[model samples]
Target chain A: MIEAHQISVKIGAQFLLQGVSLKILPGEVVAVIGPNGAGKSTLLKVLSGEWVPSDGEVWMAGRPLRTWSILERARRRAVLPQDSTLAFPFTALEVVLMGRTPHCKDLERACDYEIARTALIAVGALHLEARLYPTLSGGERQRVQLARVLAQIGDTFSIHPCYLLLDEPIARLDLIHQYSTLQIVRDFARAGVGVLLILHDLNLVAQYADRIALLKSGRLIAEGSPWDVLTPEVIQSAFAMSVVVIPHPYLGCPLVIPSPGPDLVPNSVDLIGRCKEKK
Target chain B: MGTPAYVLTVKSLPRRRRSISVLTILVILLMAIVLASVGIGVVRISPGQIFAILVKQVGISLSRPFEEQQEVVLVAIRLPRGILGILVGAGLAVSGAAMQALFRNPLADPGLIGVSSGAALAAVSIIVLGTKLFGGLFHALGFFTLPVIAFIGGLGTTLAVYKLSHFEGRIQVTTTLLAGIAINTLAGAGIGLLTYMTTDVQLRSITFWNLGSLGGTTWTTVGVVAPFILAAIIFILQLSRPFNVLLLGEAEAEHLGVPVEPFKRRVVILVAMMVGAAVSMTGMIGFVGLIVPHLLRLMIGPDHRYLLPGSALLGPCLLLTADLIARTLIAPAELPLGIVTAFVGAPFFLWLLLQDRRRGKFL
Candidate 1:
């Protein structure tokens, strides 16, 4: 389990995240939802120890976060950013091999090949192993990065509890791959990994997330299961839009159907129906 | 969690790094260049005489009356020049590789941090002013003070540039480039001022120093630079894997266990020292640092294990050839070393830039 205690992050004169705290348990996939500049990414960064919180602390498996070195932190937890660009035309397998950096026997050693190759198979990108990473499409690149992170954690799946913090993992993915990526996260949690994924799509959060954390202006506005926190009134107050909340057709979780923004006049070319198709 | 897994990966990586295989070719080429350089000079001694003189000098007794002219030309005149070529080439190239890695810029070179300007300014000062100071004081310290003053000047200018580039505890690329320009321009004006005040003979010395030449190579200059150059090369090579980690970006490198800030500081210091020594000895040899490593990267890929050492060998081979032309092109009239280096380095660098563009990571 991962827990934070009044985590506050201040960069220079501005507080990017302030006194926001939450807990993520094993076998749970939690998604934080908010508009742009709502501290969604900042909260994830803090929890992953990519950015240190200026106030309070983070605890992992009952141990304080800062007590461990960055290498140790990386070995136990994995983070995948929205987009990453390699400077060279590295092979997709080479990109995945980088995930084994933290797990290498010595700091001077290279990656473990067997573990890296196995991780590629786990992500089902084993066929693209020889393809150039930069030449791959966006969805393919994201999966390769996920594969790399999996290699870093190795088979420690049953031993060391790994926390996966995915920042906008599929913001640019197409319809089919979006659900496929979500299924990978769901499977990870089923194997006892705790995932705190940042997603803007409320429907995907509603369909998959076991718990929900609502953030606004760098603070935790609310936190609970989808049914308790994803209310139409909460959505209206946070995003300044009306929404209709109802049970998912199968999952029984709350669904947010957003009304148009206050000033956005309804155009004849509407987008709601096509967006609902994704759910 | 155990050491066994990492040992397997670490051992395998070296094999992959060594599989480039061209290193053996480069070593052979360097050896051939070294022998040929000793054989070819104004006197045009035969290869046999050159080999005999080299062996005889190493205490292998010969039956014939020692060829005084052949030994002097081969051992005293040509050998120093060849060694100087290798030292300057390897020093500049390795330093360039380090600078590129530190800055994460493929275009970075030894002179990026103002080492060339620093050396030039110091050498010019010694040529124009030191001849008057130590030349008038103690004649024993007269001829040598220029290199000493030049080294101090080179190191000082680099420190000044480093200070200017460092803002808010991080050295940003734009700031480094801007500071380099400022230092180079200021040093350029200083060089111009010194040139104006110098006598015609002193002016020639300053001019040749700026242009870079192994024309007047001596046993003493080679002795002064060779050990330092070898030491620096060893130091830089140790950082090869660390440099690969650094390519992941500073935050990521630190997270992966590299001490980024310390690495940056050490690299800057080592590059400054190597470049300072080279410039003080041979003025400024451009493009060896910029082009050699770049060509190596294209040929073998961006893995620094091959790139750094490959540049070290290839750089010397290229420099020796350039210097050979500089000495022999006009026959009795030698061209400046910088002229030949820049002439060769520019076209090669442009070709690399074009190829990088085709690869689509130019931006």
Candidate 2:
């Protein structure tokens, strides 16, 4: 399990995140949803050990994440930052192979092409096979980055359970790739892997995430399953906008319809999550 | 189904692990340059005689009896200085190459970063001040003053650059460049101020320092700078993988488990040791550092495994060639090696820039 205790992150004098505590168990795909400045990325940075929290610390597995070497952290977990750009003309395969950095034997180079090939297959980037990564579109790049992260997870791991933390992973991918990406994460969750994704598409979050951790202005306002967290009142309170929450036509998870209104917000969720006093 | 299927077919065929072929080539080239550099000075000595004299000194003669006068010319005068030139050149090139990678910037050069200016300052201070302090001691120690003071000055400036230019874990390339430029300009003006205060002979010394001649690079000068440069090269060659990780940007490099902060600090110091020593011996030779690794990268790839040693060998070769031309072009008058490099390298830089524009990409 991965968990944070009393985590607080202050950028300059402003508290971007404060006194937040959460634990994610195995087989959990928790989606964190928030408005633009709600610190979703900041929370992910803290979670992924990319940014150290000002007040508290994070524990991965059972030990402090800080105690683990960088290679150990990399072997156990992988991160996909939002704006991962491919600046080189390295082949897609070569790029996927980079994910094997932490575990590539001899500390020199990689041998098995199968791992990278398989990652490409897993992410469905195979036909773009010999294509230069710099030539790929933004969505294609995102999928390739995910494949690279997956390759890292697959190669560096030693059966201690792997976690994937993605920051706004699907925002640029096309719908089909987006659905496939979520499906792969769901399948991984089912296989007992831990996955935390920051998502803006609430409908997909409602459908795919096993639990939703609603955050607003750096504070976790609500946490629960789709049925519990996606109530119209909760959506209105979290986003400060009215949303018609109805059953999905097929999955019956809550479907989101933005009502684009103002007064529907509860005065309390904001006063609490906004003020962000110690609980 | 809409996902590009080709994206999944990653590089699976077993390719040759990027090996040490680059190192082997550099080694072979170094030996060849060592042989060639010995024969290239203004006094035309045959390659045969160069080696014969070199061997006789080692107590193994191959051909004719070693001529005392010729051996004196080869071993004592020309040979040591040539070796010094190559050492300083290769060391500065490697330092510049490593610094470029360490800072993750393309435009970095040994001369631009105050290493050369630092050496120049040391050289000038000695000429300006040593004459008084050492008295007739000046005549006995005049030869040593330039190298020692230049090295100390280079070291001081290097530390200043390190402190002023680092912020958090990042090397502010722009700030470093500006700081180096600012320091260099100030140092140059200080040179001018020192120039104003000195005698005619000291003014000539300052003027000559600015032009960057390889005139007095004797065996002892080579002896002083060679070990530092050689040690720095070995250290830098070991850092190629870290340089590779660094090319991916600091955040990404750290994610790949490279301790970016400490490694960058080490790189700057290594660079200082190399360039500080080199510039102390040779005045401000240019472009070997900026030009060689870049050309090598285009010929091979951006992989520093090839680039570092390639720069090392190529840098010395280019410097020796420039030095040879400097000697032969005007005969005894001798154009400065710095001028030769600017003449050769500026055209090449323009061509590369034009090529980048044709490809329409930012390097």
Candidate 3:
């Protein structure tokens, strides 16, 4: 399990994350959802050990996250940042192989290569293995980066239950890839890896995430199973907008639909008048 | 579905094998160039005589008595200069490759980052203000004073740029570039100020040194700079894998367990040391660092494991060729080494930019 206990991150005078607490358990996917500027990415950064919180601490497995060496921490947790810009023309295979860096003593062993290949296959990016990264589309690059993070902590040699933290992994991906990528994450979760993803799509979170944490103004406004956390009041309070919470017809999870604001409601008389004028 | 054809093709022959073959070929080419460079200097020495002289230096008695003057010329003058050329070339090239990787921008070079200018400023200060600043200690340090001061200046400027560019543990590329520009301009202004204050003889020496030359190379100078260059090269080679990982971006590298901060610090220090030592000895030799690594990247891809070593080998070859031209182009009245390199390298760089533009990509 990975746990952030009352962690607060301050950048100068502004508090990016304040007294936020969350825990990710093995064999589950936790989705962090929030409006813009709600500190979702900052929370992920603090949890991933990329940023040191000003107060409180993070514990991974049995010890404080700071107590572990970078390599040891890496073996147990992997992070896929929101934007992984590759300026160089490295092939997809080479990019995937880089994930095996911490594990291998030398360049790479056959087993390491096998693990990377397996990751590429898992992400449905086997075709991209030979293509230059610069040539890949945004969605394709996202998948390749996902594969790299997977290969990092998902090595068959690792016996510990690992954690994968992805910040907006599906932001640039198309609908199809978004679903497929979440499905891949779900599979990893089922295999005993804890997966935490910061997502904008509440429906997808409802479909895949076992639990959801909603943040508003750097504070956790709600946290529970998706059905419990995706309540209309909670969504409205966190997002500062009205939403209709309904159960999905197929998956039976809570589906959030935003109500149109006053400005967006079209007046039938005005619309008809404009149409007549155009004619 | 079956496996993809591209995967199968890539799996058939590993890319590592291809990179290794390319590296081997480059090493061989470097050797050939070194031999050719050694033979074609001011007084032409045949390949056979060069070999005989090398063997004789190793304490092997020759069947025919080698001419004493020729032996002295070969061993004493040309050999040290040739070796120094190799060292400076290799050092600058590797530093260039490492800097490009560190900044995650191909335009990043040691010269662009103010390392060369900083060294030049320090050396120029020593030349112009040595008597006033150091008094009697200037002569006491002898030939060592300039390089020592230049090394400190180079290292200090690099650290400043690095610190200025780094924010909250992340390296901001634009800030780094901007800081480099700021430092370069400041160093250039310092050089200009020193130039204004110097005597006529000091001004001439400053002009000549700023233009750069390998004419000042001696065995003593080569011996002094060799360990730093060798150490930097080996250190960079060892860092090749981490540097490769770094290309994925800093956060990604960290996720893969690369201690990015420490790695970056070590790389900056080593590059400063190598470039400092090279510039202090040979003055400012531009473009070898910028061009060699880039050209090698084109040939072998951006795998730093191959790119770093490839740069090391090809950097020296390119430098030796440039030095040979610098010395021989005007004969007894030699052109500055920097002019020869920029003349060759600037055109090649522009061609590379045009090619990239034609391809609809801006590196």
Better DockQ candidate (2, 3)? 3
TM-score, per-candidate, Cα-based: 0.85, 0.86, 0.93
TM-score, predicted candidate 2 vs. hidden true structure: 0.86
Q: Report the candidate with higher lDDT, 2 versus 3.
A: 3
Off by over 4 Å in 1: A24-28, A59-64, A105-111, A155-159, A265-279, B1-19, B45-51, B62-66, B126-179, B353-363
Clashing pairs in 3: none
Residue A158's lDDT within candidate 2 is 42
Per-residue lDDT tens digits of candidate 1, residues A67-110? 88777787778787766655655577767666766666423333
Q: Which predicted model would earn the best DockQ? A: 3
Best by TM-score: 3
Binned by DockQ into CAPRI classes (incorrect, acceptable, medium, high), candidate 2 is acceptable
Q: Candidate 3: deviation at residue A120, Å?
A: 0.9
Q: Which residue segments of model 3 deviate by more than 4 Å?
A: A156-158, A261-279, B1-14, B64-66, B135-143, B168-170, B352-363
Off by over 4 Å in 2: A85-92, A105-112, A126-136, A261-279, B1-33, B64-69, B130-176, B350-363
Scanning candidate 2 chain A in windows of ten residues, the lowest lDDT window is: A104-113
- The A-chain TM-scores of all the candidates are 0.88, 0.90, 0.92
lDDT of 1 by residue, B150-243 (tens): 5567678767876776665445667777788788888889999999988999888888877888877898988777766788789889887668
CA displacement after TM-score superposition, residue B325 of candidate 2 (Å): 1.2
